[model samples]
Target: MYPLLEVHLDIIGENASKVLRLCEGKGIDVVGVTKGCSAFPEVAFVLLEAGIKILGDSRLDNIKKLRRAGVACPLMLLRIPMLSEIRELVELADMALVSEISVVKAINEEARRLGKFFKVILMIDMGDLREGIWPINLLSYLDSIRSLNYVELLGIGANFGCFGGVLPTPESVSMLINYASLAREYTLSDIPIVSVGGTVALQLLEEEK
Candidate 1:
């Protein structure tokens, strides 16, 4: 048996449902993030059974594990795409949060090799100073991505708690929405995922009416 995470299952369920409700009719979807020891396939399977439409994690291995266990759902990789694991990332992930067109190029090439469409969320730094495209440079980056092979430009995302100071708020969310909207001026609508990062946003998500 594995070690327990001591996560309150009821809190998880309640949190998941609460987050989903916040996204409902907002023209966005909450991919219930399962990385906080809750990333295991069994726990994620429970969330899926409860009607969560998406599962998110930082490790491609977890996605691979879940797929191997037949716990298939719409899996999203929340980690930065490494230069090395492009092949496996392409094979296992339905989507990812990324920072560069080079990484996007790699994902697109791998998707082409596998003959599949890959969804991707461009991670914007958004004053967070973390693993994402610099906010000032993001529009150009999005424009650059428009020519890539099989990337479905999902939306923009940002890490709030990752780099020490930034926290998720209505302001941050609005900033991200605006940043993503700039891209929309160049492209079309239906940009799929706007991955607001970490548990704080998830908490605010749970706190929504």
Candidate 2:
């Protein structure tokens, strides 16, 4: 007999609904991350049906797949984009998480060439030690990003538990919010989004209950 894996999408949808409801109450919108499932359209559909308006993935290929499948909701690139893939990333992703000024510049240049605007979420390193700019260097990056003509600073985000095994705490969350405030002040624009949650954060919430 061949090995088989069964995916119970009904249960997944129910859980997604619960999380969506909780986030909605707190004025938070959830971005359903599909990298774990390779951005399978079926699972992505379940998340959308459960009220996830934006879909996020770590791979540009997965984003392309979702687009090919006709999932028109806003797609987010969860990983820091590579400079070489800037052109395709600009076309496939509605928004992307970025930490480096060079990559942002590349994206901006490509967006200019394509005659399209691109959105970016600056990533701050809030004790995660993962893919993000150091808190001390944020202002410099913000200054550079603000001067860009084609790329819009959508907001900020921080990774937790993905690397360095740092657990998400209230203090960490507060730090991210503080950085978001600083970004808004420095950019002189209302940086609307502050993405600071992940599976570990969700598990923390579950443990609190």
Each candidate: RMSD:
2.8, 1.6
Residues 110-202, model 2: lDDT tens digits: 999989999999998877688898889999999899999999999999988878888878788888899999888877899999988576777
Q: TM-score: which candidate is best?
A: 2
Instruction: List where candidate 1 sits over 4 angstroms from the true fold.
Output: 1-11, 22-28, 202-209
What C-alpha lDDT values do all the predictions have?
0.78, 0.89
Off by over 4 Å in 2: 203-209
lDDT of 2 at 48: 95
Least accurate stretch of 10 residues (summed lDDT) in model 2? Answer: 200-209
TM-score of model 1 (CA atoms): 0.86
